[model samples]
Target: MTMIHAPSGPNLEQVRRIVTEIPGPRSRELAARRSSALPAGLVSGSDVYVRAAGGAVVVDVDGNSFIDFGSGIAVTTVGNSAPRVVERVIQQLDSFTHTCFLATPYELYLAVAEELNALTPGDHVKRTALFNTGSEAVENAVKYARAFTGRPSVVTFDHAFHGRTLMTMTMTAKNRPYKQSFGPFAPEVYRAPMPYPYRSPGGADEAFAQFELLVDNQLGADSIACVIVEPILGEGGVIVPPSGFLKRIADACRDRGIVFVADEVQTGIARTGAWFASEHEGIVPDLVVTAKGLAGGLPLGAVTGRAEIMDAAPTGGIGGTYSGNPVSCAAALAVLDTIREEGLIDRAQQIGSKMSSELNSIAAATEVIGDVRGRGAMIAIELVLPGTHIPDPDATARVNRYCQARGLLTLTAGTYGNVLRFLPPLSISDDLLAEGLGILRDAIAVL
Candidate 1:
């Protein structure tokens, strides 16, 4: 298969040029309009309204260009308006927009499912179900797991972010924004200790032991349906579990007859130098949930797993009206094609190496940087008080503001809100990454 190279067009320069303040006059006007027109609950990290984005740079309405390190929160991994994805989506659109996959199934949907079944880890007989968002995929995975195991309790990790849906919000660990006032949540969802190397009371081994004990005593393996975890926690500060931690959990699930679900929403689709983050640990989870970067910029989510587990759901039990829309499926096929043909997995590794090196160098000099962690292109630095490991959310916000002011778009995440996570597109050029990293270094230096 031929690789789809980055599309070239006007204003696609891989350079940052700020013509106005971070939120220029035009953007300010848009923000004002947005405030009145939209709900106050929907908050945006940046005030700049984007006009166009491709490769590494995003151009705002006021003609300011900024290096994009967020990639629309890891949605546009192949870069915005990727040529292959656009072509496929347009072709599918011209053929048909939506017939409602449940009403009239289509070939594109089946094709995307087949691709996912083959691409995800584990060579066992696998099946896939599609949905419109990560939350839907995760919820459906739980449904299938519960149905297959005949259990009521589901286990999730501390600092794990599944989705915004009620059930997923219950699975998540953060309280201020995600969980505050959003109770009472779904029942039978238990939270366990995750192996966060930086903050764990003991180390990964002890964390694993405690997690196993929790499962055995508190939740009881016989009553558990599944254990859901992000191989690398994304919104919870890009926390990567220590080596062998994930495998140990998987083994525990296997020995207990519980379904092991790996939530690869943010770490899949070549964002983590692998098709799925579970591959890093050589663990074959019984069920895998994916979204975010699955369909370029279009919305698509998938649950791929062992055939018996997936088939546990009754007919008409796990579908939506717009599930596996043809247009999104076409985009997903193109994304998979692009990842394989363009060798983006290797590119992600290269990006991760470059980013980790630069960030570690900065951390060595900056006392506020408590830790530098993550794998592949999914990396982050946790900001803390100058002399202690106490979270410094203010410092994190200042760095984000500084980067945004200087034409570098960055994202901040963490359970404590003190982590600056980087998820730059694999399509970003080396020079553009260097420029963005330089801006980040300056932001940290001034702090």
Candidate 2:
């Protein structure tokens, strides 16, 4: 089947066909070269090396085409090599790649900043500062919020994955690979309980109550500069909190004069049906940090917030040399336009409904999936010990490998590592979705 292609790219056969072994010969050769040239610490999702990709399919070096369910960890939300992004970048390259936005400003930078300020949740006079990655955006947002509130404390939650930078790694809750010996972490960062409805024995309501009490009693709202949270925890396993939980958090932050930041790095840019995951809760954050899908597949991130809070930073307090590279800014502009012009926001909702229903059906017949949750295309299934809530990381690993070998890309997440997260591109065809989900069902059946 010629799966529905995005506006442009290679004319690839959309079917997931494996012409050779999973890694194939060329990939194995590259792996040997990579081991010596690259650090062993750098982890990769699958063994296949992508030669070309577009829409929901990636052609490996061996000419094997796999269904791209991961979307490069949600960076390719507009789909890889999207025509608009490609055209915009090419046009920018014909003029200039970078003059450094700080040294000699450019129109693309202003255009992107304008787009962000208008597109993000609040209608209040807002300002946006662009960055190169999610970690930089998170760190910059924290610095500016502290500048505005005159407070030192920052609050995050358990089971949160902010990013891999120094300050962000400090904010992140996972320790094994993301943290480990990287500490001497930044100080004054506090952790609240995540309202995980599936794993929390006491339930989401009680967990939120604890979160409120902890912030009020221990951290003290007066000391908090900001409370940063993922509207739907992405790396922590696509955990969707209880309804109204996010709104209450927003309410508390507003009441205390605290800057509430929605770390929409993974959930923003229509990955969750709405423009942002925070919008799904009707919670307009004081600060919204965005990345991932923002630049199609390029590295671009931004921190947008109320004008007063954002302008508190000193003139030179934030911004890097390549923060808003012209090429990346061009791609981001195209990303916003594509999402608007192609109706991908509604597409995400449609994909989510189908995936969620199918996963629920699989859960109904199996003892492995303890829970199925998440909004839009960002969904996951928590594997657990049969008839119990105990995590089953081993089973999660087995299923991931099973899918990977069979031409399906999947990711493993969660604190306990028992959650298999799915982040398929919204541009994926219904036929490919059915075929990929069928492979997933077969993987679970053997487990």
Candidate 3:
């Protein structure tokens, strides 16, 4: 795919101006109210209450315009309140809101399935099942894999995050926030090593060997049902596996008759400059799960895979009351249209190129940044102690706060919590992008 340097357009002012302290008076009030009304377990990265968001800017209640680098945790890929999405959602709302697709089938649901089946990797006869969240779709995919293979064991990779549900949390490797205390997780799930470019010298051969060892010992070939992994590890600090590693695993799974599942929840929908991150590795998974940005800002997840595998489940096996809400389906169709018509596939790569270049320049000047890595708009900087690879979560927190205070919204991730990840919307203008990068540079300078 081609990477274009020029930005196509934006939905809001490119300027980011801070008129007050980070969490201004209005936000403080909201926080106080939230403390009483909501559970303290619900954590927010920023104290600023978002009043409005457009393009790559999230305006707070105190009128602070913060450059958005998180994209609402990789949602709103088409930009918040995208014109097409708004229009379609409004039209759908005017007609009907919740006719539950399972009880009363709608054309919107079928249209979304068609779009996903056509767009996802591979030319096989594909089928799609939509749900309200990524975790649900992933669980269904697991169920389908078990049913199709008649096997009990399922496998996920290290530093991988599938979802917050019981089964997916078991799939996730992180423990503190996602899995801590959420115990008694689903059984028959196994963990394997994913190739980490910065941490592992394995590249592809070592990754393959690890997989072979895992299959041979922990999980017998005949007992294993499927192996699910992200093409690029998302919350695990935007970890991009080495070249050929993904393809090697895919080939192995194919040969072993074990279904290969690609959890593209965080890296799909043109965020990585491709329709799906699997396209980057030229690997066609048996089942691919997608969410986060699928329905613009609306909640939606789709599991698209080979028709035979998806059809393995019973007729009433995988579905829910709000599986495919009409409004969300309409928003998803619009999101797909925006990506296709506006050439976001190439735009995403362009954003990545620009961010990677800028981030590399920063890394050259400081020891705080140990590695600069990612593909397309999904990028990250792994923070470390000066002159060493030891994780520095405190530094990560400090830098994140600096950016937010200076009117730039950034996010932190990774197993060690030392990664500053960037997920700007594909529509971010060149000026805003540069400004956000400048803020990041200044923040790192202080660190």
Stretches of candidate 3 off by over 4 Å are 1-12
Runs in model 1 deviating more than 4 A are 1-11
- Per-candidate TM equals 0.97, 0.97, 0.96
User: What's model 3's TM-score?
Assistant: 0.96
Q: lDDT scores for all predictions?
A: 0.91, 0.90, 0.90
Worst 10 residues of 2 by lDDT: 1-10
lDDT of 2 by residue, 1-447 (tens): 122223225355567888889888888888898999998899697888777788789887877888988999999898888889889999989999889888999889889989989988878999999999999999999999999999999999999999999899999999988999898999999998887888664476777788789788988889999999999999998988888888988898899899999999999999999999998999999999999999988899999999999999998888899999999999999999999999999999999999999999999999999999999999999999999999999999999999988999999999999999999988899999998999999999999
Query: Where is the poorest 10-residue window by lDDT in model 1?
Result: 1-10
Model 1: C-alpha RMSD to truth? 4.0
Name the regions of candidate 2 deviating beyond 4 angstroms.
Answer: 1-10
1 or 3: which has the higher lDDT?
1
Give, for candidate 3, the lowest lDDT window spanning 10 residues.
Answer: 1-10
Clashing pairs in 3: none
lDDT of 3 by residue, 163-231 (tens): 898999999999989988889999999898887778776656776788899997767889999999999
> lDDT score of model 2?
0.90
- Model 2: which residue pairs collide? none
Error of 3 at 149 (Å): 0.9
